[model samples]
Target: MERAGIDGFVYQGPVRVSPIGTHALYEGQARFIQLQFLSFALEDAPNLAGWRQKGMLDGEYGEAFDAFLEITGAVPSEIDDPAVALFMLILDIAINPSRGFPIQIESFENFLIDVDAGIRFVRLCQAARDEKQVLSLITEYSFTQYAEAADILTSSCGYDHPLAVIEHIVEWQEHSPVAKLMEEKRGFTYDLSNIVVRVMSSHFLAFCDDKLSRPEFFCWPGAWMTGARASQDITNLFLKHLSLFTDKADDDGIFPRAIPGVSEENAVKTLTAFYANVINYDLVRQWILSDGPFNYEFGWLTSKHSKEDMTNSTKQAFQHAFGASPDSFTYTWAEVK
Candidate 1:
């Protein structure tokens, strides 16, 4: 069992029977008894305590606690582990309130036990609780919210779904002070500015590349225009270069422009100059690969499009601007003129 990565324990003992049980029975009977137990030990078990402690200190555990309160609508004192408390709360929400017996909850608990997740399932539950919007979406949109909740809990812990993260970030921004300020100043009453900022800051090249490669994915060309209206130097830089990767507007040379902002002529010239400098200095690839908050935005694009296609489009964009693919381009930051 040790060779097979199984831990086991054995027990042996002698058995004794009552002599009065049968008149013909032997006075004493000798019997061999054996038992074996098997289980797997946790790796780095001590670290979990420290991790939980740190989470508590850093407010992650508190956030989970608040989410637990929201989901279960219960006071914090009633629950031992916030994660398990949340899980039970979700079960209550999923099950019919009129039912007297919680058979479904019992069966689900048994299922967790069978999968050996019973001991540490709280961690997974905590992750699901962190993404409150996803939970709410599942509740409203899914007929089987219980199963969906389980799947979300498991996936949140195991996978890095970039798009979902982006959505969460964008949604959070929509309700933020920045978004409200932009709305009041620009007369745009939506999250378009935040989405633009998020995309530019996090995934600009990948986003444009995806839009260029798959026109269908370019459902919101106007969003890019809205980004242009941000009037920031970095945003202008993105729009100028992005045009080289996208289709030129119609005969009037008119591109989608946001209302009450920089004039069309200035926008074009600024973007043109920005594009020129980037291409001239071989900065196209660097901009895409630079270490920044938005560097991995392309990862989010892959949720809806093929990674290969996104890569190819990015390579193509670089080639269009720099006359060479990213891999073949020899310019390094130190070597740049």
Candidate 2:
């Protein structure tokens, strides 16, 4: 909760190295993400380490977690790798904290369900894998506390690839989350689709990036989403943009601007500042300077507006960019008006 020295941009000593400094000091999308994560979590690294240490020693936890939430501005349902990593870290610290972190907290946003669903599903999948020989979903993992996840896995996905199973759910299961979202939001695009895309793609990409994963991980996935091959810088920009930054609260291309407990004032001060530091990293910055004012097929920019408006907007944006320098880049957008 201390100010000044804890800030990521100005933080001296170890925190500033590699976007995330080492305990003392310190390439792939994984590498970039690892560094970027340090930027967000580095400020609280000491607090987290202390919390985990104290929690492990005293068996009481979570008084510091609420403040950590305020400091990190982590929303539980956020599936971005950084937030997910932070969530994983905190989970390890607070799993059995005397009162339990979320359970101890009075707010619903901190509820364990948001983070637990994936854990439950994975455990269920493991159960079903072992159950393949026994032909029953009643393994110790499934029976422990994830009977429902077990049921969903067995009833819907079986023991096949998670991506294939998820796609099957979206495509074939009429009442599935995506299916229902599609039916209800007939003409308009929702952030739900993007969330679905992001979650699945992150899983696939992380799997591919992982060196220790199963041997079969090398096989191509069967997912039908639109995606492009991007270098780590491009991937970092896209991920950081989509995850932490956005155009405007009113933009229909994104979800309603809401990060549960984060106030608009703090959102701007905290999240906006966080995003600025993100793009300023040399690798990410150089790429943006060279090839930014980017457009993707279904990105938020092209997701809205007619072809004429889009074309005009692009022309205007590039016209402004043409005269700009590496120094011209800032957190603010160039006026295209």
Best by lDDT: 1
- Tens digits of per-residue lDDT, candidate 2, 1-337, equal 1253342324452322121111111011232233324433444432334434544212112323233344444433322223333322222222212113212334233233222333333333334344342222222221221223323344442222333333333333255664544432232222332343433343343332331222111111100011232245434433432343356656644332444344555444443333223223333445557455433123443356675674454444334445544344455556788
Give the per-residue lDDT of model 1 (tens digit) for 1-337. Answer: 2243322211332222211221111111100000000001223322323433544313332333343445434343311233332344332222212112212233332332222221223344456557654434332211243345544654665522223332334443355663554333233222323333432333333343333332211221222223222236435444534432233333322233443454555444434443333333444454566642212124332244565765666566657755866667344454447
Where model 1 places Cα greater than 4 Å from the true spot, the runs are 1-157, 160-164, 167-199, 202-262, 283-337
TM-score of each: 0.21, 0.20
Q: What are the Cα lDDT values of the candidates?
A: 0.35, 0.33
Clashing pairs in 1: 202-294
The backbone clash count of each candidate, in order, is 1, 1
Alpha-carbon deviation at 152 in model 1, angstroms: 2.8
